[model samples]
Target chain A: GAGVSQSPRYKVAKRGQDVALRCDPISGHVSLFWYQQALGQGPEFLTYFQNEAQLDKSGLPSDRFFAERPEGSVSTLKIQRTQQEDSAVYLCASSFDRSSYEQYFGPGTRLTVT
Target chain B: AQSVTQLDSHVSVSEGTPVLLRCNYSSSYSPSLFWYVQHPNKGLQLLLKYTSAATLVKGINGFEAEFKKSETSFHLTKPSAHMSDAAEYFCVVRGPYSGGYNKLIFGAGTRLAVHP
Candidate 1:
């Protein structure tokens, strides 16, 4: 009955540092996704995970962005050498199956790169 | 590629008045449409969805949306809006070209305000 959850609801990082955001998908959810939204902009796709497999990463802005879903249930989005432009609300969502097109979103991690 | 467009950046209405939030979508194939609402400091919540099942889809909190293929629209509406309806609304679309994943493309959200 629990919904998707993200950790460090707010994170502040200095430029050139590294930061990792965590997502805990709903119980038994097989599909996971990550999104980023800048001020006054809609959310943009970042990556997707089917179980433990990283299916799509095309939306990742640069090589500095990396994601992993090692055990298929939890995921992490890591940004290396964080830049000021990376500041935004990082959202995570999960669905039950491939056909479960409706995704349940988390509170989102508000990341600030100073 | 699939995309969504929100017609308005903001919508305001008095309590008990009809609510309308317009949205347009683009997809190469039959699209699956959805409406999501987000309260400040909270997660996004699904209001309703329209697959191939019906032209008009009803969702929670007395909200509904009509899917018009010809107009490329899936606008959300309610017979009477409550003060609590004030929030940010998003229109999303999932096209048929997904490679085993449901990539929901979202529109610029519309901020709704309700007045007493």
Candidate 2:
């Protein structure tokens, strides 16, 4: 069985540009989440998805952040007008169900805004 | 609301010695506690989880944690430290969120270093 996976393990972007991070959750996972990890800090929640619906986006720092999981299996987090403060590791996780406690995580995409 | 605190920013121990990583949590409801390990350039791996099934939870790689509601603690421990154990450990708590889903809140994390 395969675990969650993320693409572009590392990304370097210039300020004012837009960047997109991809996440492939385990097959049949009913819940998906995104988090951000800054240097020497714990991961902070960003957004969540249940099936094809974006259930929560309150954690998104600003309107510049957008996420989509149209098909319900894969997700993408897009940041518009990237800023230095947005530089961090973007982590994606998935669970068997919304009630399940165990969340399998991906390797994450480390974004650097220069 | 739920939050976790890793008592120590870092802990260093010699190989073969006992290891302890302390964590405390605050939550409005019954919390689901977990310990996750992260190696350099790797994904977060679940070490163990406490979902009220047991007070003492055993996880992979001979690691375990005890959930104490009175102390509000779920500390991770290993009988003997191994050099391979050097990495970052996080204490996480899952609590109710909007839409009937649980949100995971993580601690700042503890960096453990094992020296031989």
Candidate 3:
């Protein structure tokens, strides 16, 4: 079976530009999450989705950040007017269900804001 | 709030020597702890998890961790270090359950280096 996968792998954006990262969770996974990893730092929670509903977005740093999982399978994290501080590796993870403690992660998309 | 602290920023060991990565956690209630490893340019991989089951948890690649409530620690250990084990390791704790799901809080991480 396939694991979680993310697209772009790497992205370079100018300040104030918008960028979108995609995540494809494993087949049958019902819960998804997004995290951000800064250089030399551990990953921090960003948002979470249960099926098609965005359950928690409290970890999202600012209003410019948005996420959607309309179909309950694939998800996308979008940043509006990206800033230099937003430069980091965007990670996506998924679990089999809401109660499952284990999360499988994607390779992540490294965004560089210049 | 739940959090984890990795006591050491880095650890270097010779191949075939013991490996120890220390982790301490803070939580309001009984916690679920985990150790994850990350290779360069790769995704985080779960090495082991302690979910209030057995106190000593075993994981893949000959790695294991013991959950000690009294010490507030869940340290990872392996009898012998391998060169392939060189990577960044993170100590994680499951956050308070919210709306039927839980997020993860990670420690700063410990970089392990193995020399032959």
Candidate 4:
């Protein structure tokens, strides 16, 4: 029984650098969500996917953020021209069916922009 | 617009004492409420959820919450506080999604501290 997995538990990048965070959802999970959590704050939604289609991305902060799930099972969140305010923990979650509301989360990738 | 409000930013209790974490929500319609916990350096773990099945929902670790439509409240409570119970708790509300998708709206969160 495997849960969601995120790559590079921790990453440090320069303010203007580009960074990519990867997420592997549970096998066969049809729903995937990405969120950003700042220090001492609750997680805010970033984007979501159903299979290979990008369903919603209204939560992405700005144009610097981009996400893709081309294969339907794995998703990636990329930040270009990263800024200091972009530092936070990126979380990924997956659920068995789109109809089911419960979501299981991964450990998350902590990104620090210096 | 749907949002959750955790009344207290932090709650401290002595071991063996009762624990209470308050949450209030606002939604256009009946919403599914959830409680999630996160330990230090760990990911979020679901404690329980209210999916309109029952007004009073029971969760893991002997915790429970009663949904009050009148008060718009879903406060979490436990019989007693344990050291292991100290963690950050988030109150979440599930939002209706398009194309049969479901999304969660999260609260700011409440930090719990247990002292022996």
Q: Best candidate per DockQ, number?
A: 2
Q: Candidate 3 DockQ category?
A: high
Q: What is the DockQ of each candidate?
A: 0.79, 0.89, 0.86, 0.82
Which pairs of residues clash in candidate 4, taking residues 3 or more apart in a chain or in different chains? none
The RMSD (Cα, Å) of candidate 2 is 0.8
Better of 1 and 4 by lDDT: 4
Tens digits of per-residue lDDT for model 4 on A22-74?
99999999999999999989999999899999989999999999999999999
Tens digits of per-residue lDDT, candidate 3, A66-113, equal: 999999999999999999999999999999999998999999999999
Error at A92, model 3, angstroms? 0.1
* Candidate 1 vs candidate 3, DockQ winner: 3
Q: Give every prediction's interface RMSD.
A: 0.9, 0.7, 0.5, 0.8
Give the alpha carbon lDDT tens digit for every residue of B9-112 in model 4: 99999999999999999999999999999998788999999989989999999999999999999999999999999999999999876778888889999999
Instruction: Give the winner by TM-score: 1 or 2.
Output: 2
- lDDT per residue (tens digit) for residues B3-26 in model 3: 999999999999999999999999
> Which candidate comes out best when scored by lDDT?
3
Clashing pairs in 2: none
Which has the better DockQ: candidate 1, or candidate 4?
Answer: 4
Task: Estimate the lDDT of model 4.
Answer: 0.95
